[model samples]
Target: MSQYKPENPATEEEEPDTLLMQLRRKEGSWLDWAQACQTLLQRQKMTPQVIFEATGFEPIHQNQIVVGSQVYEGMAKAGASPAVLEYFGRKGSDILYELRILSPKDRVQVAELILNRNLNADDAHEIARAVKNYAQLRERPEGFGDHPGDAVAYQAWKTAQQTSDLQERTRAIGRAFQYVHSDGARQQIERLLSTVAASSSGGSQRKILPKLSVFRLEEDLPRLLPVVGSLPLSTAAWEQQITPEPEGPYHLIHSQGQQTWVALPAWSVIQSARDPVAIPIENRLLGTLLNQQIPPEEAQDPVLLVVDRAVRQWQSEGFFLIDRAGSLEVEWREDSGSVSLFGRVLMAVRPPRILDEVVAQDPWQLDE
Candidate 1:
């Protein structure tokens, strides 16, 4: 067999040993070192452990440099200023690593923020997380613009608004003050601070409800419906027939013969539900998509999908429970064409696993 050679063999001047030596001596900027490490791993086929043995660099440090370098390249490509590039070229590997979670445009914006504010790694982490979370919101709250500072301030402001605790609200207000960029955003925080101050004086305090309420499977009881298979009810049956009970909020539905209870919260859409029902997830493909939202072990267990019969119109990309031929199934609005919407899916509820039953199945743990 002919001798195997690398597709792009390195010249004597650009050999693997030369790269290793440069890394060992710390001969160039941190960016250059990062690139050299990447070249060794990808082109030279050297493992991080082998490189660590050759040079004093640890594996974790290697990972940081490689990833941070990519983030730096993204910043540069996004037209980051020369000062910003120069500042990061020599140091701030940890800060850059935290920025890898951001998009290219966001990376440049945040890098400039870091440079301008003289922020540390921890601050960089907070800024990146805030920006990412803001980006994922379906609609931005009024008065908060799209700037990096605005994103941070918005998060702080939101926290302040939602929290009823005195200390937590104070901390959130402080953070909002620190990050508020625009005058409008500043005014918003000021109003929130004023509320806190007024509340301290024993004025009529506005109570903010907690955003999430925890419901226990064994403790709480709601309306119950025993269901079989994935189809809960036909579109006509829900729209023409189902009505709320006079006793209380009608929400929970049980899967017949299975330890599952599908519950719907008193959301505005759900409260308006004429007759909502719980459908057990039996389709494999549908179950796979829904599995992304739940724990992996629960993938095989039945997922109770709460359907709101009140919502029949296609508003967005929400998953709708529809009637396909005689069979009821879950389908995304984007993929389906002109089908009658049985109900829009309010949420998917996965029942908590019975760990005691699992422990009983282990033969080694059985008592004599």
Candidate 2:
């Protein structure tokens, strides 16, 4: 029997294994792969560490089903993962696959299935081959990122990966940071970290957030937003390119598809800390607080929000929970208008009230 898997009509791709086949075809055909992955991970009761390992620590591109941390997205749009960036000193995923053309209706139907949680890895190969047969029966399907050339494939993958990293980390850091530190950041983070259990309900929207048994912080974190919308736990990392003088010493960080290299007017060093890791979270808040306390001109430097385990992943790159001593902060910039600040003071000064439901498998135990 041929272990080779058939192509998925939606993804317009074929592979030897059903998972890889569906995974290959799923590029550009799916609506939100990251959300889908989160849904599946939750059902499996996989922990955050599991997700971190299976998929590199970052948001799975909504349109791509990433395999091996390398992108097999649409034909001309193939890219690389950030994991490769850190090692290669390149900030993007390189496209290892070529682009292929896909029919419109077929693309929509296929992508929807993945986004809708209508297919699983086990049935993906059969489903894909069947879909291709159906699409071919109705009309011929065109391949987008496919070619017989291996060199072309390698270059395409490498280029795509590099391009994705540059585009994401270079552009989207501020927005993502502002997102993760908002009032409901913790809840939103916990939502995706929830246990990956199969849902008893139907409907696509119901499948998004995962169910978590528990999500604990290293310590108490501040809550700064009012109505925190749901947040996905996205990750990224980047090198710091600081500009001297007027622009002052700004740090460049990359994560996801975005990078944040905002200039800091002045920065403080915690006492005489040798390592960046030793720079305490509270030290980062000195600038914000001094601006409030002492005279304006005499105020100390603005501190960069630095978390111990995440300076590379969270701070510099752009996605992670952030809190300096008393308040949480995420940097957001606008093409027009002033920057928008999203975050809240810690719960110590004021308590936060939230409404959450706990599912009881044994209802009788509660009554007894």
Candidate 3:
């Protein structure tokens, strides 16, 4: 027996191995428990409502993040690539829902359209229709002859997509008739026009023009009376008097917001008053041509003089007071390459706030 028996510490110490074994067992047990819970969830009898009632486990409220996460996971399970999943995860359920309904071809087209630019849902829908119709027309021999509606839809869609300017888009859509010729297609075109008109008519009413009354302090009236001044006070007279020479039939389009007074020479107040997008191309081109025809000597100084005289009248004698709720500033824009100016003066009169700033006294003050 004789050589002393070797004692091994590895055999003696079981704590570490036992602890690891115990942990593994616990983990396995936990996984089994999770599987059981998942199975229960899959059963119709174990609905979320039932689970809540039976175990008081309240369901998580589906906020945007939760909804998005679930959609992401579902898409992932359906074999969508990581990139595609992440891209769509940023859009809401409405867009995803719309995509899910489309054929793979349309889905790809729409996804590309969305990825390339900023578009609203309506725009996306329109562009999608255009894409689909365009595809159909390409396959058909008759083209717009067979499907005039598709021709109109495609033209409107392409114009809206390509042009950044609204007026240009309207002009382009108006020209859609050149592409489509069938009587049925004409009806579709008419419907589109009617829709546009209805929406325009239903939009917010124009802002009320402010009541302007100029007055002089009772004490200053006597001293200022001798130095006479002339200002076109009424809105109509203001438009007439202030119009630049090389004469335009300029009229004021009074809207309450930023572009307070858009003075258009030839177009109706409605045409001028609305956004540039609303104006037809013909009108815009006409306006530009008219502007170019004016001689520089005649065009440059008249409108500025009008504003200058008005400001002077307001400041004259501390004798003038304008108790209105807005401010006025003149702005001029030259077409990108042309020498002519699109003259406009902004007047924003917010109700309930009167802006009164001191106008510096003119150097040549004539004393009574």
lDDT of 3 by residue, 161-190 (tens): 355444664676676654455665556556
Residue 67 C-alpha lDDT in model 1: 86
Candidate lDDT scores, in order, read: 0.75, 0.29, 0.37
- Cα RMSD of all models vs. native, in order, equals 17.7, 30.1, 26.0
| Candidate achieving higher lDDT, 1 or 3 | 1
Name the Cα RMSD for model 1.
17.7
**TM per prediction:** 0.57, 0.14, 0.23
List residue ranges in candidate 3 displaced over 4 A: 1-83, 129-368
Residue 163 local lDDT, model 3: 52
Following a full C-alpha superposition, what root-mean-square deviation does model 3 have from the true structure?
Answer: 26.0
Least well predicted 10-residue stretch by lDDT in candidate 1: 1-10
lDDT: the better of candidates 1 and 2: 1
Worst 10 residues of 2 by lDDT: 91-100
Candidate 1 per-residue lDDT, tens place, 1-368, comes to 11112223223348888888978997777776777777788778899999999988888998998788788877877899999988997799899999999999999999999999999999999999999999999997878888999999999999888889899999999999898888888888899899999999999798876578886563234444333335544545444443334342433332334434334445555455565667776435555555645346654776677776667887667888777665566777465567877667776666665768877788687664
Q: By TM-score, how accurate is candidate 2? A: 0.14
